[model samples]
Target: MEKLYQVALTMVEGVGSIMFRQLINNFGSAENVFKAKTDKLLKTPGVGKQIAEGLKNKNLFAEAEKLLNEVEKQQVKLFFSTDKDYPSRLKSLYDAPSILYYKGKADINSVRTIGIVGTRQATDYGKQITEEIVAQLKPYNICVISGLAYGIDIAAHKAALDNNIPTIGVMASGLDIVYPAQHQKYAEQMLEHGGILSESPLGMKPIRNLFIARNRIIAGLSDIVIVIESAAKGGAMVTAEFANNYHHEVFAVPGSLTNKYSEGCNKLIKDNKANIFTSVNDIIESMNWDTEGKVPEKNTTRNTEIDLSQYTQEEGQVIAFLRTNGETQIDTLSWQTQIPVNRLASLLLNLEFQGIIKALAGKKFGLKL
Candidate 1:
């Protein structure tokens, strides 16, 4: 159906995320874009003749159908940008993947998410720090995100599992193919609480460029990214750069001056790109998270009854979404309610004043508990 066309459009030659967005905007759906005439395709912005002709290839649909069938068989969940379950944080980014493949139990859109990245050549100190940070974060019940590489990435995933925290690993390879192969057991174990995700299609191999590209998803999914230990240049640094670009808070754990792995974290601190990560208190305070023993129940039904008729339709729309989805960022609220952010901000402010909702860290709003 429409999902098949969506996968096919992404498979089309030279159809990157930006172009995909432009085409979807112009045609209103991927199905329409594929059905359009070559001349019409050429008329769309940035659609060069080569791309226009590529859309006419009948083989793309067949390939997409084949991939979709395999995806269903593997029990992997596919998320196009427009899908309801697509990660909202990534949706706001201009260059995020238009399609994602996920397999696991954890919600990718968990209310609290953190990214932990570092050099593949992690030292004993680095691994210990990664494990400790994750352990302390258990009470917060946050989803930990990382690229499923060696060193700090694996340490973070293993620690999360030990603490029974939901974690997500963004992989460079297809969901069915676990790179490094050594971590396959950990990857499988993650399925019990966390899961693996990838933008690569069913049979895509993990290439050099894709690994670099995967860092952005790690950055985009997090409210804050922690660089445990990294060299001056590595995938972790690239992830930090993406996190900075996305305006998400970045924290770097300081290390011994002589250690090569500390260079990236030090440079990030020197360049004023990240905060100094000392302990769990830094995260708790920076993110404005409660210091209580356990995270309170969220999105639970309220015992008190309140009439929706008292508010304007737009306000009701916002309230309805929050009631259904729990804490929501302002951007997602705007998208779901079809209200402009500026106007929605005012509505949220009104609701906050009336004690109908409360604002959390990161511009999220939830019904008053």
Candidate 2:
């Protein structure tokens, strides 16, 4: 029932995602937002009389009920913003969606996630570069995230699949509807290793504004945004802008200035909004990944001299990985070490408590400097 109300809150006219979030934070729940008095709604930041009245409309209850039923019937998981299963990276955004409709399975909190975005009209060069980069990243166990559009987005997804890496396709439309329609096959295949995620409700059309809105999710879900190709203006550039605002790393492949498709990438590089992306090693080194699970011998900081023989093999391996990578995400550590996520999570917490290492934001861990 609470989940139903959460879905309805998104349906309310004039109540945008950010507004719904503020309402929920102030009132404590989506059901409470509907129950809130007009005076109380007025007191809520960003809520005006119009939106307040919309919230009071009884028609929304039936609509939300219908949608909830449909979602359940379709096996689509409905994740409220406050739900434990919601994407943590997205939750950090001020405008994070109040509800998410996802199909398929993925570790949404995968620490080594990278978003590969570019123009819908990808050229041969763009496609080749995307595949090559994804191929190189396969060894590092990176999750490839994209908007699931044509061209570069699909290329990234396919490349990740070919290399056996997990990838996620973010949708501007509802899970039931695939935009461009022809990519449905690709989306279906992605589910084997990744997922299709969206903020839109079932039956919602893939409007232009929604595509632009979905770019934020692509940006938020990634540790870095790499634009392989883009025109002077396109959704890829928009995603890059959102990524920059989110304070995540942004990278762009440089192309000939005369190429119209490369204009966006060149402009981003010229403006210093993104780093000049060249190879997968750039991403690995930039993020300080533990590629081969070897500890950097030179990082003899803090307790480096302490004998790790006292710790369990798992703890010792984790310490060694962190020592090599400087700061590694817990999920990456789990992947590299072949430790189950749940077990690794417990190990990380124990290590943090024991002062052997410290946990960082984005579920990362690093040796105490």
C-alpha TM-score for every candidate? 0.84, 0.81
Model 2, which residues run further than 4 Å from truth? 293-368
Q: Each candidate's lDDT (Cα)?
A: 0.89, 0.85
Pick by lDDT: which candidate is best? Answer: 1
**Deviation from native of the Cα of residue 29 in model 2, angstroms:** 1.6
lDDT per residue (tens digit) for residues 21-92 in model 2: 788889999999899889988987777788989998899989989998899899898777787778877765
Query: Which ranges in model 1 have alpha carbons more than 4 Å from their true place?
Result: 293-369
**Ten residues in sequence with the least summed lDDT for candidate 2:** 293-302
Highest-scoring model, TM-score: 1
* Clashing residue pair totals per candidate (backbone < 3 A): 0, 1
